[model samples]
Target: MQTLTGKTALITGAGKGLGKAVALALAAEGLHLGLIGRTQKDLEEVARQAKKANAGIEVHIKVADTGIYAQVKEAVSELVGLLGSVDVLINNAGILKVGSIVELPVEEWQQVIQVNLLGAYYVIHEVFPHMLAQKKGDVINVASTAGLKGAANMSAYGASKAALINLSESLMYEGRKSNIRVTTLNPSTVATDMTVNAKFTDGNVEKVLQPEDLAQLVVYQLKLPQRAFVKEVGLWSTNP
Candidate 1:
């Protein structure tokens, strides 16, 4: 296993849910953190927890909406300034608008794409140059099982996650020579606010995958040896 001491990680949507859990887990391993989220209060809370885990570790919080390119650029710049250099980038900001293609509004679909797909792109684009210059970095993109399999009433959300998977693959190809690793994590039915109200085809909320479990998996990946890279991991609950 590799140690995370002296490393810095930037995680988007880190104010709550899986992002928050991952931040705490990384901090436990001695990684400094940059928490990016729209909610200032939530970001502060996560930062507090992360600092508690590692007293010497630095924590930088930035309130930025990942869907906006300018905001994402500014946030990345601020994070780099505060933490020196970002060693790991976690693209976890996304939204779910469950609707069939026939009934889904164009605006709603666009909003999902903007946040889920384009948002990841904006972050990666801003951070990749620095990673390339450094010749070493890690990117972990939080996708969904919808990216691998199409489900009913998930046109927008599924399409966006699928795009993220493709983007991660493309990034891996580009960064191979530079020793930068790109990983895509596809999980099903994580128990978060986003999934709490989500109804399946049978009108039941699937609560099999928890945020902490997802966080543990991400931390495990980060602990792997530098020469060993798990490019893509697909996780699903047995009950789901």
Candidate 2:
């Protein structure tokens, strides 16, 4: 199995939800972390938890909106300076805009696209060179199963994820020569503030997929053999 003990990972949306879970998991595995998010409090809390989980885990928190290219570029630059190399970039920052197409505000739709699609692009744009330079890395985009199909009342979110899925595939092929692995994680429904508040998943998270469950899968992919990689994987609950 590949060892991630001394590797560095940058996780967007690391303030909360699945991003936080993945950060803590990776920290436990001894990876230094660069946490990017909009909230200082949330990011700090996560950083604290990471330190508690692994005292040796180095953590750097940046307040940046992934939707903005300039912020992402600056944040990534600073993180790379601190950590030296970003061996993993987790593009997990996203938002939920649930409503009918016609009735939904245009700004809301745009916000979703900005954060969900362009956000991933911005981070990937900033981090790709490091991966290329190092000759090894992984980029994990946390998308949704909705991206694979047209769903009712999910125009902005679904479309953004769909574009992200395609982007992930394109990156996967482009980075193969440099030993970079790109993967898209399409989860049906996970217990997070985004899902629970939207009334999309069940209220009882114990019955459904949790953030830690998805984090496990992310770590599994990261631990795979160097010559092998998973292009895409979807998670679904038996009853939800």
Candidate 3:
């Protein structure tokens, strides 16, 4: 396994759920962190916990709404400057809205697309140059299994994630030449606040996947030697 000790990682949606778990896990592995999210307080808390995990690691936080291009651009630039360089990018920021097509408002549907799909694109667009210049990097797009097939009331969310899956694959092909590994993760029914609030998993989280479970997978994938990489992963809970 390649040690992540001195590398720096920039994670979108780092305020909670899988992002927070991954940040703390990476910090324990000695990676400097740049956490981006809309909430300043949540980001600061994550940063504080991360520093406790690795007293020597540098952890920086920025407030950015990934759905907005200007915020993403400014936040990424400032974080890249603070961390020195971005060795890994976690494009995990996303939103979910549930309603049937006829029942779903047009604006709400577009909002989901803007946040879940365009948001990831903006982050990658800004971060890819840094990775390309370095000739190596890892990019993880935290999509959802909802993209694989459609569900009754999840049209907007599914469409957004499906687009993200396609985007991640294209980037994976293009990045291979530069030694940058791009992996798309499609996880089903994680017990995050999003899922619980959406009522996707009845709050009986122990029976389904958890944020830390996905975080462990993220760590494993990133730890693989640079000579090899996993292109995509679809994770499901056996018990669920």
Candidate 4:
């Protein structure tokens, strides 16, 4: 297995859910972290947890809305400067809006797309150059299974994720020449706080996939030798 020790990782939405879990997992593996989120408090808490996970690992936090191009550009540049390098990137920042076409407001629908699709694009646009210069990097884009099919009351969220999947595919092809490994992950109904609070998942959280489970998967993928990488993966709960 490859060692992640001393490498730097930039994770979006690192304040909570799968992002938070992955941050801690990577810290445990001895990777320096650059955490990005909109909430300062949330990012601070996650950074604290990551430090506790590995006292030797460096943790940098930045608050920015990924939907805004200017903010994303500044955040990525500043974090990269602080962390020295970005060997890994987790584009896990996203928002979900559940409503029919007519029921969901136009602004809300646009917001979802802005944050999920365009936001990822903005971050990748900024980070790709650094990875290219380094000639090596790993990127994991966290999509959702809802993108694979249309469903009732999931128009906005599904559309955003679908776009993300397509974007990730294109990025994978483009980055391979530079040795930048990109993986697109589609997880179904993870038992995250957002899912539970939004009532998106059934009450049986125990039967559903957890944030830490996905975090372990990220760690495993990153541990694989540079010559090999997972192109895409669809993770689902065994019983849910």
Model 1 residue 213 lDDT?
Answer: 89
Candidate 4 clashing pairs, residues 3+ apart or interchain: none
Judge candidate 3 at residue 224 and give its lDDT: 96
Model 3 alpha-carbon drift over 4 Å, by segment: none
Model 2, 1-240: lDDT tens per residue? 898899999999999999999999999999999999999999999999999999998999999999999999999999999999899999999999998899889999999999999999999999999999989999999999999998889999999999999999999999999999999999988989998999776567667788999999999999999888889999988885
Q: What number of backbone clashes does candidate 2 have, counting pairs of residues 3 or more apart or in separate chains?
A: 0
For model 4, give the 10-residue run with minimal summed lDDT: 197-206
What's the residue-level lDDT of 171 in candidate 2?
94
Q: 80-131, model 4: which lDDT tens digit per residue?
A: 9999999999999999887889999999999999999999999999999999
Per-model TM values vs. the true structure: 0.95, 0.98, 0.99, 0.99
Give the range where candidate 1 is weakest over 10 consecutive residues by summed lDDT.
198-207
Query: How does each model score on lDDT?
Result: 0.90, 0.94, 0.94, 0.94
